[model samples]
Target: MSRRVFFVTCPKGVEYLLADEIQAFGLELVRHSPAGVWAEGDLAAGYRTCLWSRLANRVILHVAEVDAANENALYEGVLGVDWSSHIPGRGSFRVTFLGQNQAIRNTQFGAQRVKDGIVDSFRAAGAQRPSVAPKSPDVAVSARLHRNRLSLGIDLSGHSLHMRGYRTEKGIAPLKENLAAALLYRAGWPEIAAAGGDFVDPMCGSGTLLIEAAMMALDIAPGRRQDGFGFEKWLGHQPEIWLELKQEAERRAHEGKRARVPTFAGFDQDSRVIATAWKNIARAGLEGIVHVEVRPVESFTRGEKWSQRGLVLTNPPYGERLSERRELSTLYEALGETVKSAVPGWRMAVFTGAPEFGKSIGLRSFKQYKLFNGKLPAQLLLFEVDEANAMTPRDPDRSGEIRPRIANEERASMLRNRLKKNLKTLGQWARKQGIGCYRVYDADMPEYALAIDLYEGRVHVQEYAAPKTVDERAARERLAEALAVIPEVLGIDPADLICKQRQRQAGTQQYEKQSATGEFMTVHEYGCALRVNLKDYLDTGLFLDHRPVRYWIQTHAKGQRFLNLFCYTGAASVHAAVGGASRSLSLDMSKTYVNWARENLALNGADSGKHRVEQADCLAWLAEKPSPDQRYDLIFMDPPTFSNSARMQGVLDIQKDHATLIRQAMRRLTSDGLLIFSNNFRRFRLDETLQSEFSVEEVSKSTIDRDFQRNPKIHRCWHIRHLS
Candidate 1:
């Protein structure tokens, strides 16, 4: 307790905030560095910081600082640290070196030098040398080398503080426990907790945000459940001081009043994540405080009894690099809409790494906090959503009179810059190749740009956005200007370019439309279409992202009977029949799509003798036909993410029923047959334990279309080889 101790504090930026926090505990900050804040405090105060500092990465107690310019100096300096007092005679220790100076070029070599110094010191003292523990150590010694000065310290927190022990199950893309807590803290949850506002994470993945919020609301020390602290093993360990800190933390928890522990609720589209969130809630012992449900954002109407002032914190998908931002654009916009319509008085906090992606939500962030997830710098964007609009009593006559505000024009300018570069490079090649049709580019989210396809020297653009929302028509006009510039900039005839808008569909609408060139292609409920060129759209000739599995079927379908389920335009079956399949049956409940599939077969010169396209409910079709005599040899199964068409026997959930579908498909497959099942669900996880019945090899690469390279997980295909 008498020794001069340096406290090393690592926080996720906002050092002044942490310094202020330390100062609040009566510890004056001695110095500050990039890695942490340096303060002179006794062993007791160091332990206190580990327990209370909400933003610190970990706390370390300095053992020694010495002038160690060379290898010998480094060794001698480390040996002089008096390790016997900190670590017991022969206790295990790990030396982690953060190198910033000339003495050490490599971190490992520096660490080794420190290790040698400690070992040699013990040996010279006639005491046994302790072994090295890398993963976890009885004692953690950190060595920072800068300008020939060696600063060594003992890590008190042991493990990274991010592992808060609450999350028992990991959903797809679950936020790291520590990062989640940091996000909550960064979003000003502490103030919200003190103010009496509730917290809700509608897109909760494993209840991270909800649990973190609950801990904040209840004044629960995140480290309360932690079993050990590094100071316990130090030579000057003070049991009474540590106990007092813990008791004080407990006292605060008991004394904190949250206006009746404001209601915390989490909702997810996936039942699995909901179940995982439930387990996590229980693991955190917060089952009574936190509630989670399986519900889509669209179906999530605010609970009638809940307060309107709660904070809405969520980490919705950025779609990552795996998904096309275009595919999830509407979802993001819909979420923004939901927040504006459903939760009228709530504030919103969203954390995402993609800047372009943040714009996709349409709601401008009031403040953007820079935080990190491991090495990736992320922005915690805060939105002061005026749910006043949602709660407003609608005037039957005046409700439609409110004019919508324009989206940030700056973002559009940024998009224009990016499109300029892309067009400057790819436009000329497209026109010269007679590729009048192609996907101009895909929008990230919320922007909802028209999918431009050039057909017969004219642009067929599909404007996919809500009707009369903002300056959507203005965006279309900007796109038209962009399309017009493409031909001239690329040295193509300006007369060859024209623009037309493809109307947006609601629900399960389908239609065939002729463009300016009179070429007809089928369109589905989504803005996605089956076109034959590269100039007018972001994609042409069907979504090629599904190419790999389609080709997988073509290669395996020769002379084999095939069944293409969820056969959108029967693209896969056409590939199969073209590959000389003996017979192919395409099943889709959409009659328009069934006819489209037949047209595709005709376009490919496929004969009707071997091809049969049927409009039937896939699930019901499978149920009615029990025998395997007329079973398929090659089955192509691709399902919608979530669908509840009246033609179906029941609502289809791809994630929940994939195992059953795979099992059923396997039942109809020949001994050596291949069943290719796929889904476009971005975060789809296969039933590994269930799929074990069949040899399932992922054929994602084989099924990817060349045009869809930007979006790898546009669909994921698995090749099921029936157990022979």
Candidate 2:
């Protein structure tokens, strides 16, 4: 038996799992790579792996490796290969080429060249050219190029091995068969089944895990259930040997099915999906082996006395949107409760996309296996369900400890260190530039939930609203610790320090005065003077994060007309006016803030006639009146995440209304003008249509100051210009 190199592809992050599965077949020579594994084995070894290996996407047999720098080189190299021996003349084939080079940037083009090379090789050898059959090819060729080197192989498995033939019916976001098998392998399902233990998937969408686990326990060959494999149609395939393997597999499957199998059950809350799971199980010929039923998390109960200890596995929904987090938090907490109350001393493998949700489950895990569910980076948390992991002392003081916690103290120490480190660097930069207002801390410590800044000599502190689950007394103590640390940390007096808590503000709540202290501190940024109100507003008159953006406006404002939309306090307008802009107009819904913007302009000594402020809902203003006919050469538009104001006709959602806003804004821009659009919403996504409508370039990195280096996503800024 002569050995040959074989490439087995799997999902990204599952290379180690696939390598382990391949090595189990005694292939001794297995190397793992991104999204796949490489192995060296004989024909029988390859066949056996294709039949038994569960975590592989495709088993490709290496034919030749070529040096191809361009498409022509690629075609010549492919033509040099003897295709007649690999496939008969007129054999229908399809080529799957991956990667790109200087000359070939498209996979479709590379695939076409490879197909041409194969056909030319057959025709050049005086044989009839093979037909191309993308639908159902007789021979499937795989090619990939990296650094001018190409690796060509013939597919031994017809389609991806993840299509294990049992799942003709699938639910939304259903787990692929190979991924499900990998989860079971990581959870020690085979070992548990070997010990007469059972298996359960509490949230099984369509019983993918149940069928795969049952197959693994019964030693059933995946290829046996599959209709046809690519090798069966290959010219190099040995029919006699394949027949023997098939017979042997059938006999083993029949015997394995009759053996003592582990009790397996799948439960889903959706009754509709339960029927689909049963249909898929029967399709896989596991009629009485795997049971499925409709069961909610709240109704889950411990298994009967005979089957109590085994593996509980599930792939629960991980909320990908911010709005879904609150609801999904409850779901995860409920899942944790169900698993804890139903099965103790059992091993559980919970796959979730959000690692934070794992903490809500109230159970701690000993190990986490990195895996991928499609393109999303995911984790397989292996938890040992017991009293030691989930239960502990709940406040020895009985009334929830109100003093400084050791954990919070340690975190505060770390935050202090981080702040000092940042100040040593940013403070020097700020002083060198003659700037007196900047951020010293932007949530350096997650537990502290505060951002500290320097307003002239005053230390302004902001505390984020704590979740309802947090103890109020403890939150206050933590706040006290932060307050005590800030003044001492910056050598500022306590009397000059201002502390405020940030809550959800809608409409004019941000503008309404919190106090009657109309005291405004004059601050200097980039040689421009501004007034900041620390006592009476949720935000200081100036946003420290947009300092660079303001400076950018200053540099680009010379001899250009500038307009600022949804402008808060008109920092950008002031910068534009300071830069000698011909004229500037700033708009905002807050009349109080509009007055503040004018004060900022006056403090800078910019012309009152050239710089003006308007109080209006920006969306309504844009739609209600036509712009002064493309007058502005420079504009800045940064909207809120969500706002519902009594002054507006309807609510404004940045993501939903950005397209219309930008289109209307574009109508007001000069032919040679630029628009700087920015927002601080972390999850904001720009409208795709804007990509073609404007010459858009991301300017977030270029405009980020040193203070925001660690938190680049704090704001998203883009520079948009008219297409020439």
Candidate 3:
């Protein structure tokens, strides 16, 4: 039992956590590294680390550390090791080399050289030369060459500790076992479990955390369930000691499981994954102990058996695997709601790569840890689920509570300068074009996420919701600064500056009115008067982005019959009527917007009998078979990204139903008619079925103004017409 050093490999960013874990296990941690940690320990200490340390990816007993600056030095260094003591005579072995220097090059070449050195060492000795086994080998040798220094060790754990030998099936983007354990450890789950506390993972996919929690609760050694380790094939292996350690662990596991183990449960929205979780649970040998069921986060209310004021932990999926990343925004928020409503007063830890999504979860996380899930960087959002923290002015993300900066600080000054620069340039361009409404600042600085548009004398500031990675506090502060600075930069009164947080909206929610102030302000756009309300809604009366499209409609509206469908506030209809359209029909489901459109028309002096506004489901109106005389020469159809209003028949997925909606509009078109179809769904694809029946062309690029240049797909516009 000579004094020896060990190199324990762990995931990046958790080096300190691993160092603390090794120290807590009574092993003397010598130093820390980015990839792993260096520690002083004997054979038992190394063995114990493999048996107990959960944060470690692999426990490597330090065999040698040498300066292998060149390939010759590397060969000699590895050959110097007593290969006979570790690698058996001519037995199968795998060499895994990590990191690289200028001399060693790629991992494959380094691995080859290490293997050759091991074989040449054996040949130089009387022992049999070892053969290479890439997949599974008798012994696993870990090697590293960084800064011309080589550190080598025999991997005591056969597999990376994350394997745990229970997960036969995994859900999409499953959290690795060690990382899951690290999250739990960081959240102080072990202490909670030790004190007979309960465990819960509401969005537990495939039950990794629940199984890990159960193992921790029942004092089950992770290696106890594993098949084998690298030491099993090593010549210096002590079978009796290994057997004794495992047997002791097995005894503790049986006793703990048989006796009072903390109550734990897992829940998932998908029943199939719940079954997978159950199978995973059974494989982890916690079949009867941990309960799992199919339940959404919204239903994760307090339960009698499992809700004993313990940690409600989960790694809810974020934007990575999902095609529509925006959809995850609501999912994270629902989990937060579940915590606030169901598990109040309990401890909560939400591990998500996208932390901005956590904002929707409403409950503010007091502490956050930077951790990695494989290669993806993530955060473990820790919150003390106190009901008092759920809703209050103190809630960090609540609109009322702000950390405003008023242009004095350097960062604030930098933002103000950028805004001033944009305003001077785009502002002059707007005045030259006789454009009363235009963008001044479009997130020119990353810190400032506000989209500032100058509407006549008023300023409309829409703050883009911060991503999960940005600290909520940082987002709030930047938002506050933007809110404070926009009016001053625009030379507008602070009262005239309207601020709104723009979040990801789905279906009709995007078009859904934010308020009912019924307030209106008359604004001039390209000489045509329009009514815009800076308050009471996400959008002002005029969509500044679609200024060019409205102008295009107005220029082409003279003496032509116009039809506006799903027309919100009838800005386009008003523009067309002002352009002298012979007749126009404005159709909308919301009577409020129809009334608003009427006001916009009246403000422009185009509220005449020739222009009519109708409050009806636009989809139903389009469905009706119109008389031949009802055909229009010009149609303006801008449908919502999605809609399921009770007034409508079914959900309107713009991407899915665009063809039907377009064809229906074309059905009421004159023999040679033009339909301007547009939508704000960024992912919307125009249907090609009508390409044969109509001349379809996306005029989005030409119609997009300077204000919306950052996102060209802000709203896609197409000039479609009957081929005839």
Candidate 4:
């Protein structure tokens, strides 16, 4: 039947491209709107459009268009349409309404009226009326009420096309496959391929980008692998025409030149993600073109001439999953430097939901495109290699100009003056404690530009400010006035210090005020063990508060199997292993810290096999088999106070889940196993009545650190014993 069907749809920013795709299916565009183009075609054409259009969300095929001045007219006009031809004989049907007008002020009311009109039309035809189905429907009707006019249509696409059916493996915050493809198209990949440039994603999670790039480069249609589409079940289904289209699509795909072998590569630091990427690459049937590898971004090396005009596209992880904000920030900074230093003239695109966080990379963007990543508005920031605009050299220009040496002498003069005045007060305090550590004095008094940290044999200094604060400038001036005799503050070198302005989370509306340094600083204490300077680490770095429990392990660890849960840098494991434990198992979700724990074991030269580290979801792993040995004498569990990393199974609110977690740990304990449960949630109160399975004791006092004399409520530790 000849029908004036107006198709209602929205294209993803690329409207002209989608328009070209739609016209390819033999549909005629009669009119166009901002949201969609009005097209005239038969029900068959509508069905074909829905089944084949990869970019469209839902296809609404116009049933009837009528002018309705008011609500009653809208209902009656809709009822006049031939409902039997559009709807199924006896299956479910629904009316969904949208738009604004007086004829139907509320969408809910408009939908009800349309449903009633359809039901009335069916009833008048002497057929058992099909019931309204709220969820899925055999025949779904859409009603648009706008400007006192009513336009009704039938849904030809039952489900969104983004669900490509190949995404069996999902990591935290995975990008939609279609969306990833759209991003590649937007980033000028089509032209990049023509220019002989390659594509590389260092942080490729699941190989989505690499797969999409390969598919597009080889002219492979995304829908080639789908099992079914809504049009297959339609009354006007054209099997012959659909098969012809499919054959043509495959024919065109075969004629196209494939992407250069090894031109597309994806790397992920995680082994599991690399495996998932390989599976996805295989699923796309592009294993020959796309390569997946397990390697850190820092380890990525570009062969000679391979980097020229290359495209480095990466979606560096946001701090949301990895709470190591400080380290990630430094890592991003290193990445930017690597890009500038190593890959000169190469182009780059970084897709991130949080643009402000991108500042940590230290690279300025040239172009940014707003894109929707599944309701999350993200920016695909494009950066170019313009070396001329990069950061200036640290040293000022001294071109043919001779400045007074007294300025250097003046800096020395200032340092001496400051030391002389504060010598007995702060200096005596520092010297009495074996003055090897770098004495951090502001370089410029009013400028407040510098801070120096001393180590036993080496010094670590950092410039705190550039122009310098008034306090720093004044401090420097004061030093110049007093410590002139101190011989230029000898024995300190400038290279040992690190300096940068404080960073803040970018793109965040709330919590933008948070410090850039992060809430904690985790460091390796011995060779492989991690220690946090909690006081400096947003709170307390090293949990000196865990001393008593560590001491307990020293006594009970002999000839026992020790399991340190949520082992941060394996500090507790080090204590257990050092205490002569026969075997120790440390479980942490962070690979970074797991490696750190391995280092700790190597430092002590402990039996290598005796210390094992596993990176997995601690709760899920624990819920599985307990150690078959049932031989744990020291088991420590101290979870973070609170965190919301995407790596975690779910948000961990320690106060609410501590008791349950502790109870589970006790299950993994041997008959005489000691389950040490500790947390830094200061306001926490123990669940004194935990099922009577174990005896609990507060070991709060044992956590005290000898070095930390100021405000020692760093963390609270407890020991649990199961009495057989």
Candidate 5:
């Protein structure tokens, strides 16, 4: 039995674990690299490792090492190897080249050179040349070049050992099999399993963790279910040794199945993933050994039939958006409470990309391991669910209680008092007027510079960006205090409060998405139902300041053909259609807003052939000569203060281009039609020449509603008419 050098690859942080695993397989460790380890093992040892390794990605038999300073040297070095001794002359092979050098900048070219070398070697010996197969082939070759040295090897584990041959379907953002196995090992699952401790995943996605845990408990080889390996077709493969290892693995698996392994259960809120999980468990041949259910974390309770002490392992969502992150805090808190009340004496391990969220779990972590979920840095926080670290279940009646205290109680109290007074006045007035959305507070106190609006029952808070003189830390503390105070004073759930930072935006920044939650709610204003998304954008779909303007359009739109330019979400178009406008056309450059407008109209039962929403740049659309039928009796032009949107034909500065915009829009208006032009530029002034050319009246005062009286300059509006 000649000792052969083999290189094993695993995830980045699992190199040491893989080293230990290789040593446990009776293979001598030779060297360690970043994501791979070299070990000295014979053919049988290599075969056993491939059959048993739970954390390895690939097992490569190191055949040759050569200098590869240049492409020509790389080719010649590979050609020196005796091709006939390894792959057969008629066998097809695939080259998986990794790394780059000054001479071989492209990995494909490097692989091509390697392939050419082997083919030429076979031809030089007057033997049939081997063909290349990009997919599965008779033999798979591994070529790694680093620091002008290349290591060539034969890949023994086909298609990565992580496949495991069971998980054909996976949930969104599933953990790779090897990574899941490493997490189980780090959480001390083996010892717990040996003691007959049960295993559960409260937020199992496709049951990867549960399946992996069951396999570990039953001493089942990770690759036992695999169909084939890369070396099966190699000329030098020892079928007898491979057969012996496979049979031993099968025997161990068969015996371990009846060896009194502890219970393994999984639960997920998503029913789709739970179905996929059942399929995966069945495929892994652990249908009876592992159990899964479509249940949420909050519904998870310790099973009566399971052991008293077990491991509660789960991978909860690490939110990628601000709103999701905010919502996940409550989820983590609920998870903490559920685990403490359900499995008090068990151990809990949480794997998350956002470790800060782990703090919300409210349990003291006894151990923490820094790892990676693919390229994202992640951590495994292990907690003992005993009395010392357990959290008391939250009171259902006080679920909305603000948990964090305000840093400055006096300032927060002042803000709270002000909010109460405004709500008393504005809330009463909004109800009287049948308005479902209104601004309750607008930076009335300079220290707490926030604009808080109430839409239906949800609160949308926008913190105005603090001035340069304000300390960043102080501003943050004040914002936090405001957030803590708002929910308390408004008597609303903290989860219903969506907060955002308000800053001066340019070049369509205001329209850019802040999150992808896609949560939209309907609110009523002036007998019209409007759709608003409080989380996804800086400005909710319906601008609260534009309330009176939309109403004004509704009042005067009867029997008119309406045109809404820079239409945004088309709240005004909806208003016009609802107000009995004969026909309406709404134009905006954003397809998202166009679809939203259509939805808004559909929601209000106003989406008819008479009402149309088109996605077009307002400026470009205004410049085009309108057909006679395109002329409208009532036209509303509310352009952004400044826009350099890529979809637009050119830059739009309200101050510089207002006159041109008004003229172009006027060209599409009937001789007796009215153009209601508006903008939110605080320093805007009507073009003097336009006032002289047309009958223009500044309706800013009347357009500013009572909710916006504090900031009367929120927007400027005008009714432009042609002098007949």
Candidate 6:
């Protein structure tokens, strides 16, 4: 009957929400800490919390607080507790020790000490010692140590409250039930449900959000479906009080089913997850209350019979991998469009680990909350689908002009003018030369530092990394301005634009994929067809600046045995093979690129036994002595400026290792064979000592095509040939 202190724990960001829930249940608030809250409550209060609190992970009944300066003190402090009153004779128990200090560095050690203390206390009293049970113990004790002080308690909530005994099947990354409830609370779902509003999740993986929302709307006690609580077996547990609480919860749940509940619906692209969601929904006794289907976000549509006002809540993929991140951007954009068109005037909340992708949605979020999805930091973005927050509709007449939505009109005009001028000049040249892909602008103006390239009808923009001295905010705003102007000036849809930050790449970073869309488009260069993926890598499959070099190889490769080293996607090899090379071999360390090269060759009808594509470290492969059959009449070596690939034998610094690489390649070259070596290292200086060793000539000026005339230093090339 006396008031006892209790500690309630929840997820990191759900402390405040849990505290509010505790107070709603008539428990007096004592204090709050990170991930937990202390409350003053009696046995009945604890029972009610365990039965009704939706956001709590566990409820612990505080027993005592004692000084624990060291291991000895920790053991004595735990031993001083009256274990006989809580643990029954012959009952199995477990100790959960949390936090660490210099005295007790390991949680396992602390738990062992606590167990020893409890066993010794029971033995000293001539009582049967309770057995230790790691799983489903009769008594679960919690010992928390902080600042040399220990607080020991009896856990009353067995097995986290998040396990509602319904979600037997889950997706790859299932959101916890408690966290899903917290998101609903933050998104104002309770109030919306009270007003008879509906709920929808377009990308719902396993329907966690939908189930949680349905429970809230129907007033179903979250703990009603729980198997049992930790307090059920404790000797001090009052069976009458616990029975009354459980009976009340059961009555409320029975009544809630008959109450007016809001519509709860979800859709996922994966039918497997949707089937799992249906099983979960059926287990929760909401099979008819909740509806789900296998529908992608693009096909998401509101039901004609559903309420017009509701919340569109979803936890879309966070794109943990770099490739997924780029691909998810378009997915997020589609979600935003779906929300705007399908649920206009409704409220929406998106929980994502990559918050930057929220901008892709085009809708401005009115509120943001920082939360953690497990260990990953995440954000909950709230938006109202009203006109004020609606995305600016693209005007048909102004489609060819920069949108006034950009704040800096003057800067926008400048970028637009520069792009127009470049397009007028280079556009004409590209058409006459039958080039479908080329750079239209390469950071022509310092303020707008972006390389805008056109591949057929699509546009790829690479924003050059700004100097440290430049304000990052200003840089971002300028990049936004450039993005806004480039699409209009190039006469392309904004959806066709793929923007990425271009920084100094090192150690095969450029070769790493930025996305996994696998959406490749074929573009023409010198009448040769090549496939380029604009959404995937930092650099498209085909490098446009190397147009002249590939052309030169095409013109002079007639009847020559060609070799392409560091051949990315085998673009150069495709050119050589098309130019009548008698035979060719392309070598690169990346298996992905090797497969891509084979695909590219097949796309151009160049994949034959005569032209082989092999995956091997060019540096290591070149170190081996080439046989007479392996020698080639002409060789092209374009190694990365710097690569420390684990596949490679050693680090490669183009400036430092070019001589060795060139010499290795020249060994495979015939006496009259020519070796075209090139790199994009701006500050590269060819090894001067090579002049006396071989016939070397700087052909950088001649290799640069018209599209790269403005940036002549984009790459450096050298012609190295064996001297007779």
Give the TM-score of each candidate: 0.71, 0.60, 0.64, 0.57, 0.62, 0.63
Q: What is the per-residue lDDT of model 2 for residues 415-475, given as tens digits with 9 covering 90 to 100? A: 6787788779989988997778888887776667777889878988877656545786677
User: What ranges in model 4 sit over 4 Å off?
Assistant: 1-54, 65-78, 90-120, 128-138, 143-151, 170-173, 238-240, 257-262, 303-310, 321-323, 338-344, 386-389, 392-535, 538-625, 628-724
Candidate 2 wrong stretches, greater than 4 Å: 321-323, 392-724
How would you order the candidates by TM-score, starting with the best? Answer: 1, 3, 6, 5, 2, 4
User: CA lDDT of each candidate?
Assistant: 0.67, 0.80, 0.79, 0.62, 0.85, 0.84
Q: In candidate 4, what are the lDDT values of residues 110-150, reduced to their tens digit?
A: 88888888899889889888888887677778787768778
Tens-place lDDT digits, model 3, residues 542-661: 777788989999999999999999888898998898888999999998877899888788777775688989899987778899997889999998877655455665545566568888
In terms of TM-score, the best-performing candidate is 1
Looking at model 2, residue 708 earns an lDDT score of 76
lDDT minimum window of 10 residues, candidate 4 = 533-542
Q: Comparing candidate 3 with candidate 6, which one achieves the higher TM-score?
A: 3
Which residue ranges in model 5 land beyond 4 Å of their true spot? 170-173, 391-724
Q: In angstroms, what RMSD does candidate 6 have relative to the true structure?
A: 15.9
lDDT of 5 at 581: 93
Residue 649 alpha-carbon offset, candidate 5, angstroms: 44
Give per-residue CA lDDT, model 1, range 166-272, as digits (tens).
76443234466656767776778778766767787878867888887887788777778777876677666778988999999888777654346888889887665
Local error of candidate 3 at 132, Å? 2.5
Q: What is the lDDT of residue 505 in candidate 6?
A: 28
Candidate order (lDDT): 5, 6, 2, 3, 1, 4
Indicate the worst ten consecutive residues by lDDT in candidate 6. Answer: 393-402
| Comparison by TM-score, 2 against 3, better one | 3
Residue pair clashes in candidate 6? none
